[model samples]
Target chain A: MVKLTLNVVMAERNITSRELAAAIDITPANLSILKTGKAKAIRFSTLAKICKVLDCQPGDILKYIDD
Target chain B: MSKWLKFGINCVIVLGRISIVFAYLLIILPLGNFYPVIKGTLPKTILHNDNFLLLPGKHTVTAAAMQSFPSWPYAILILIGSIILIWAIIKHLKALIIILTNLRDADYFAVTTVGALKQLFIARIAMIIGDLFLASGNQLTRSWFYLVNNDGVMGATWSSAVADVWMAIFFGVIYVAYRYTLTLKAENDLTI
Candidate 1:
């Protein structure tokens, strides 16, 4: 299963959801869905934009665990 | 899909309601008048006036011709089949109107569309079975359905059901396609 660690990475970087959503040009609702791992899939361009805003790699945001 | 398409659909919905009433009257009036005269409850004098005969246009049936019918078993089948047939038609029109309303509102992928498609698919199948029974019943009661000049098709054979089978298949395909569309929309909505 692919689980997002976006909340942990944002907390570690001292960034609020609103600031990150505005910086990444995404709606707060969608950012919430992503942070809560409710999203079905993430676009590569959107991931690149998020990585750029957060100054982090995709691996820093995404984690896989066996069920 | 067009600017005035919704207007056209609304017109059809109105017309379909009227057609439903006519459908009932057409069948019911003929059966009502036919059975009473056959059983001798209604006087033959009642059918003496041409205007009093309630059969559809270009058709006339004598009480004697009606008396020649096999019996009430097939007549009962006809009544039951007609009821089921009309019910299926009503359901189809209702489902179509609802789905069209959803499209007009720009809610094409709404759950109501799936429900309407499923209803349509089931209704089509019901219509086919209803038509089969009606056709067979009519075939057995052929003497009564004669034309005014005694020159017309007596009754439909089971071969006529082929067209209904095709229609049911068409609706089944449409129902499956709509379900796939809804599934794709669900996946797309959750993607970010």
Candidate 2:
């Protein structure tokens, strides 16, 4: 099972979902889902865009928790 | 818009856009390139020109001759083909919209399933388009439409050779899209 945790990353960066969405051009609703790890998949391009905007690696935004 | 209508609208819009794209890749590009070859060379070569005296490998039709093969007829055919294909897609989209609209009042879970179906449809269309490219007998068509058959000009047909590299590139793109839409469970959940 794939488990992703991105909320902690956002919180650590002091980035609101709205702000992150604005920076990445995704809807806040989508960003919220992504942050909450409810996103079933993340585009590497989008992830790269997020990394560039947030000044972090994908590892910063995603952590896999094994079930 | 409700998720249902929004989803339906997105389906229509995406289908229209993709259909146009397919026309360009499959028919327009080949036929467009064909026009020049036909109009510039045909009559002179068909009866009098010694162009075909050499075998296919030995004979490389000149730019002018290549452009003259189908000439006016090619253009007319291409124009007709584009119109018909576009119309067919529009009709298809309308039907889809009607079906999706009826399902609008469906439960969220049902709506989500419909959304997945839409994604699957999109993926399928991409794959079909890719296959058409491979079948188009050119590098540009072969590579843009699919992956397995791009051996380049000599590897297949004149068109296939030209489209081979491009097909390779698009194959990667299709693979990525297929992976995203069908494989990545995490991100797909959101789209659903």
Candidate 3:
């Protein structure tokens, strides 16, 4: 399963979901969905934007877990 | 657009509640007076002329009229049809109130709203079917009583009901389209 490490990154950067959503130009609800690994897929453009805002690589925010 | 939708839903909710109250007061209330007719205790001639009459006032029927009076089958059918129509109205009103309440919360793309719309559609169809039963029952009553001499003159006109049925069908189609729109909105909301 592909899991998102957005919460860990946001926590390390000392950013709240609302602040990150505002900075990334996405809704807090959608950010919550992504943080909770409920999102089915993420756009590459959105990934690039999140990586730019958080000063991290795509590999830093995403991980693959073998079940 | 949501503002307009809220306003329209509020209007429908108010109108639906008022219609439910009026239906009970005007139609259901007078039905109690016809209990004797419904029970077949009184001579069915009392309802011969007014097949679809909700309330029949005090009238003295002659013995000769009683002898020639038609049976109670048509009157019973009309009574059942009236009950069904009232039931449909109440069901429609309940569905409208739920939909309006959900709309107030800006939950346009909800499954509950779609279910309510489906209920409203079914209620309208039931009302149309009730109207059909009323019309046919009235016609049968008139023919059985051989009261055709006053043709094109007195009695209830069913043309408006026919138009209403057509209007209901049109709105049913619109509701289907709205449901599709809601489905699309749901998909879009989840896409992010």
lDDT by residue (B67-118, candidate 2, tens digit) is 4344455334334434443444444454354445445545333434444345
Q: Which candidate do you rate higher for lDDT, 2 or 3?
A: 3
Candidate 3: stretches off by over 4 Å: A1-23, A40-44, A54-67, B1-16, B26-70, B98-112, B146-168
Best by TM-score: 1
**Candidate 2 chain B least-lDDT 10 residues:** B145-154
Score residue A20 of candidate 3 by CA lDDT.
86
Candidate 3 TM-score over all chains jointly: 0.63
Which window of 10 residues has the lowest lDDT sum in candidate 3 chain B? Answer: B148-157
Enumerate the candidates' DockQ scores in order.
0.81, 0.19, 0.28
Tell how far residue A45 is off in model 1, in angstroms.
Answer: 1.1
Cα lDDT tens digits, model 3, B1-192, are 477887887888788788878867756642653675657544554445344343234244456655554446555656666777777778777887887788788776778877877887887777777767666655654443433213221232366367658868876886899889986776666555
Chain A TM-scores for all candidates read 0.96, 0.82, 0.96
Tens-digit lDDT track for model 1 on B1-192? 776897887788788778777766655633663475467543342334343324466366666765565555565665666677777877887787888788778887889989988998898888787778767765553435431212112133466467779988999999999899889988898888
Q: What is candidate 2's CA lDDT for residue B52?
A: 18
Candidate 1 local accuracy as lDDT? 0.73
